[model samples]
Target: MPKQIEDQKKILLRVRKISGQVQAIERALIEQKNCDAILQQICAARGAMNGLMHELLEVHLKDTLVVNQSSEQERSEELQNISKILKSYLK
Candidate 1:
């Protein structure tokens, strides 16, 4: 796991990317791009937003529950399993 500062940096980068995606969508709208093209851009923006959500959720889980819940093997295993589930979910 990384320090909170590192996690924050990563999270912020994702957020920035998501913002850019949204701005692109707005620009497309203003330019009156084709419907299909606009929809594709919307999908891309949605995917970026989902990715951001995924990153933020993982950080929240690690910081809020996994970090100090326990030092036992069971806790570690639980974290790993949850991580796997999350990865599968995003896919």
Candidate 2:
């Protein structure tokens, strides 16, 4: 399989695991589990999400800015797009 497809599969797996962690949090709340356990799960899910975002951003930067063969204008446009995304992401 292509490297991109493999990377997408890995990302999807991470998403699924994060989803499960979120569901567990919901279930814990419904079942009146301890606050510490619920908070720990939330922390884990948040860390996983951050890790996924970092991976995607790195891949996007490399694909758009480093390995791309576009014109200067196109590269500038891509950089502007990335900047916009980062602004919203940071907010």
Winning model by TM-score: 2
Measured by TM-score, how close is model 2 to the native structure? 0.84
Relative to the true structure, how large is the alpha-carbon lDDT of every model? 0.81, 0.85
Write model 1 residue lDDT over 4-88, tens digit each, in one string. 9989999888888888888988998999889899899889888887887778777877875667566678677777878897788
Which candidate should be chosen as best, given lDDT against the real structure? Answer: 2
TM-score of 1: 0.69
Location of the lowest summed lDDT over 10 successive residues in candidate 1: 63-72
- Cα lDDT tens digits, model 2, 29-81, are 99999999999999999999999888777777776778778889998998899
lDDT of 2 at 67: 73
Which parts of model 1 are misplaced by more than 4 Å?
A: 1-3, 69-91
lDDT of 2: 0.85
lDDT of 1: 0.81
